[model samples]
Target chain A: MRDHLAFRLAYRGTAFKGFQFQKNVVTIQAKVEEAFARYFKESRRVHFGSRTDAGVHAYDHFVYFPKAFELYTALGVSKRKSFLSSLNFMLGNDIRIWEFGRLSSNFNVMEDIVSKSYSYFILSSPVEDPILTEYFHWIRHSLNLRAMRKAQRQILGTHNFACFAKSSGVSVRNSERGTTRRIYKASIVSRLHPQMKIGQILEFKFEGSGFLRHMVRNMVGTLVQVGEGKGTNIKSILRSGSRLEAGPNLPANSLFLTGTKIRAGLYAPLRPQTE
Target chain B: MRDHLAFRLAYRGTAFKGFQFQKNVVTIQAKVEEAFARYFKESRRVHFGSRTDAGVHAYDHFVYFPKAFELYTALGVSKRKSFLSSLNFMLGNDIRIWEFGRLSSNFNVMEDIVSKSYSYFILSSPVEDPILTEYFHWIRHSLNLRAMRKAQRQILGTHNFACFAKSSGVSVRNSERGTTRRIYKASIVSRLHPQMKIGQILEFKFEGSGFLRHMVRNMVGTLVQVGEGKGTNIKSILRSGSRLEAGPNLPANSLFLTGTKIRAGLYAPLRPQTE
Candidate 1:
């Protein structure tokens, strides 16, 4: 029987190329796997809940390591804390494993995820905010929050999102799942940036069944165009299903994978199990 | 007769070696000077109200360029806005000249200053915050706010802050102005970090006549020691006047020069005089 160790991760993605393992470049998955190999004295295949692009941050992300039943059982409850601390020490400052538990052998990180939410921050100000350069997409022109919110309503519910997705020529066409996606909620709200005396942060939040490649960023880009009085028709763009019809893709730095939810009872407390 | 153009500058000092111009390494002063030279087409000496160390941010730092009256006068009120925009384009995203005007020829940036205030941010949390990596110093152990506040009171009032200053071998011994300085206010306050769900930010604020090199950082470090139950005696450390008595110097990235108050009525609006 195979047992899996599931963990929750939070990371600042500035230094990382992306969440996935890539050749000749540093990535979050590569670092996590490296740390896991060092700790367990062996290599194990790790599964991520979602793959985030480069410079994207995560408040809560899920990952699982397969075939770890025997090794994890030996550590027991007392060693778990030290194990996590050591792993975090190895992972460095950019990534942190905040929570971990035992996953049922049947649990699949990709298929089991029920929902995912993301937040994109925009600093709408005449002057660029130096401190928020990494976290926010600075816009020199003031954003019209009301217009963006109005346009945000159009993105809610099920729709064909090919206009917002990257054109993956053959794969997307051949895949069972098309460009259609269901957005549970989409909203835009403005808040005073904590650090900056001037300017407000426009938070664009989206909760969905799943997101296509560059979907959220493209949606935000379209909404930003509406805010900028660029006359973006989100409804028409959705219907057209043409990538060229959508707004420009926003940068990944300001994007955040804020939440990921999985089916309950799939995770068990990490402890020594007596058969 | 040298007329001055004064400006309020804000910058994230992560990329800067320091505020002062040094050979080879990039500094805030060097960047600003480069921008000035690019815009004005002449090498002009710039004066800073304070010299902050590497990775130290500033929200409201003051700077002045003497003999800039002619160039500034030529660019009438109509052209000033465009000029500022052009200069900001040259300065890039990390630094900004938010406000600028003319300074009276008699107004001395060093002597005419009323007070300066600085704030240091500390993230007291078990896990490191990745997004705030450049802006805050993360401490794993929980800090005792009450203990820190009690110790902060000892920093108020005038005293020889030799313990908090960097050792300047010949300068301290021969300078007419000694290490004695008056601190107007010293306080510590806790706030919920806007970005983080887990950690609370402890802000240490100091307002004083003048600060010695590394003074604020050393003071914060000693206070952190007190919070950690290290039994730091601020009074004794101040009395000792020995740098060794103080706690470790905190990282410069967490320190910010928040305010610089110059003498009132010293600034004149940037305009071509009707006379």
Candidate 2:
């Protein structure tokens, strides 16, 4: 039990390429791993539930690190917490580490994730808000919520979502290899922010076994089209996987990776994710 | 009212200095006047609060242009909103025309202002939000709310805050003239953003007749120090308006030109200043 570790992390996506590693571009995975490497004084390998694309965000994300790993064995609570605390101090501002806890050796972030969900907020208002201009998708015209819901229903049960994934431009073989069974839990709910900007915020909560690359964002774009009275049969688009093209992806600033469903007997506490 | 003309403005403070358009460097006043001159196709005049510093921001802050002035009469609303909008729009995101409304010739954003108010929000948590980073100050330790409030009382009455205003290198003589202020209300409120990376935000609201240059920021800095257990005698601090050569200055990003106080009979609504 003492040979494993789990970290609950949350980050603003604006400054990161995504939760994975990449050169030149700043990615969340790179930063967090670097911190872990420094703290344990040796490299500790890590894993996450989803591979969020560049500009994606996480609310209560999790990371798993192995204890058999040589890096972190001798560390005490103050040293561990201090490592995180100092990273925040040194990194200065762009990212923050919330809290960490030791996990059982066999825990896996991806396999244990029960459901992975996302919420996309669109600020469809004519006026530019003095405050909220950064974190939302700003649309000028009103969107049709009912129509959008109708189109959203087309993506419910497990289907090969090869049509929804981004083609890496590698034309060779099986496009279907990337996907696993996924269930669309519920229709999106659209509401206005109560305090300041009077605009529409569309939220989609999906609890699924897993996800495909760009699948959620593409689905949202197609749904937004229906909401804007732009189209009708998105199911047919999915069936043939024909067009191989998606409409304008709403900006990543508004999309939030809210929660991840994890295995219960595994016992991961509800805490902010590591940096 | 039929002859009313709207204008878009841009300025490089590094050249003329701040928005006030001084002779020392490029003042915002001169740059704005230049834009209005080109828009009117001549050197027509306009009026604003004459505040805001170098590198400050404004989305659709307003200024009154005389209705009888025939300078921009040739330009239509679509052309005006579009052309001027494009000028800033083409320049980049840093510049935007938040909105425009036509008003009577008597409109004065300064004299007509009934409530002149500003806000400073600090990310008073150990975690720094990457997304909301540019919008708030991140303080590592918990603040002394009691001390902040005690200091706030000193901000209530009309006083010459000369010590608070930073000398603009330009050092305009009499710049501190008649700078006594009556703070209508001053208080701190904590806003909890559920999805925000940071746990809680502390905001300071300051409403006064008007402010000296960098007055609010300098005052906010002193208060933050008091809250952090670094300072004493907030009143004595305010009385020494000759500028603290080493006084702590709070971050400006968290500071906002939230609102203005104007005379009751202006075209746009403004809060009335009170003792």
Candidate 3:
């Protein structure tokens, strides 16, 4: 019988080589799996709901393990599951596993997720913002939020997301396949970070049933170009479905996955805020 | 007669074992000298304003080359000097050289400073703040600002700060053998980060003629304990002249050098705010 384990992960990518597991290099997966391996005699594979690239951090990353129990005292079958928490504690600060639960055998993190929401942070300031240097893309030039929002609307809806995901993270082949996604929400948000001074910012949050490779990064990067008044015909760029037309890929520091696509079990159905 | 040649130095800490030039490990100074050897066809030496630790990062680092040069045009002298601006480029993002100036041979970064300041950051949140995670330490518990302020005041006067530094940081036979510092100002500051939804945060800022080894970190760590009510005897903790009673060292992420003591030439002091 197949059993599933769900997990939530967050990591800091500056010191890590990347999120994807590498045999020789120190990576998020390797670190986590190394701890898990110590608990179990046999190595168990972990399937992830999403994959983030080098230097990309995740607020939520779901993974399903097969009735996982790598680290534990020989209590009963039940105590094995509890060991995950203990394992997390030993894993240290750079990589963390905050929440865990059992998933149905058929539950697939990638397929079952109802929607994935991503945040593209753009920091607007006359001087380079020190705090956001790692969290958001800092643009020293003035940003026209109005223009960014105006261009944002053209991107929301059902479309071939191949143009955005062309960078394809680590698994280049999968990203090249392209994707069909429905954008449930999209908008530009502004706020002042509590810890910052001389603060001004613009954030792009979008939700979709699924995303293509690097899709969020490209969309935000293009929008930033559009915000800077550098790109022309963003609507055509969205429709072109070609990665080249989207322009350059921005830094991963400013991109964040705020939430994940969850199957309807615990969370209420999230509709568009305005609607 | 001695001629001062200004040199720009750049090095990756991880690439080298440490910052200081050593015979065994690669150092930033060694690399810069290598580059100079290629350019000048002669060996050159560089001097730094401060020596950063092994893992530390520097966005702007200035080094002086004893003699100025317009290396062969084809080999590129003017371009390389102007390339000083290029220091902010690439891995240089973490290291840079803004400008070069001929200073009196007597000038020194350590001895000639008017005042030196650094900030220590802490991410205080109900649920760990994902936004502030990378750049600062995560303090899950609440901090006692009142107690912290009281403790901060005790360190303001020009007193021997040796007790504040650690053996590793200052490396003295006697822990108390160090510089006496005058704290121009000390404050407990907290602000809302733009993206952080929940948390209490304060950045402790202090400006002083100089700093003891790990003094700011040790001070902030103790303040955190006081803020969280974990440590009692707040009065004695502040008034006691010994570092033994101070709090533990918070992570280095919380600290920053917001501003430096500028020389008369670099100073363009603003007029007092009109009431």
Q: For each candidate in the order shown, give its overall lDDT on alpha carbons.
A: 0.83, 0.62, 0.61
Give the alpha carbon lDDT tens digit for every residue of A22-129 in model 3.
878888777777767665645767777567767777777666566642222244766554554466565666665655655666665556788888887777653344
Per-candidate RMSD vs. true structure? 4.4, 5.8, 8.2
Model 3: DockQ score: 0.05
Ranking by TM-score: 1, 2, 3
Question: For candidate 3, what is the TM-score?
Answer: 0.65
- Model with the higher TM-score, candidate 1 or 2: 1
Worst 10 residues of 1 chain B by lDDT: B266-275
- Between prediction 1 and prediction 3, the one with superior lDDT is 1
Chain A TM-score, cand. 1: 0.92
Instruction: Give the least accurate 10-residue stretch of model 1 chain A, judged by summed lDDT.
Output: A266-275
Error of 1 at B21 (Å): 2.7
Q: Candidate 1 lDDT, tens digit per residue, B224-275? A: 9998899899999998989999998999999999888888888764421211
How does candidate 1 fare on TM-score?
Answer: 0.88
DockQ of each: 0.25, 0.18, 0.05
- Per-residue CA lDDT of model 3 for B96-164, tens digit only, reads 332344444455566655776666777665344444554567765566677778767766777666456
Candidate that beats the other on DockQ, 1 or 3, i.e. the better one: 1
Give the interface RMSD values of the models in order. 9.2, 9.5, 11.6
Model 1 local distance difference test score: 0.83
Per-model TM-score, in order, reads: 0.88, 0.79, 0.65
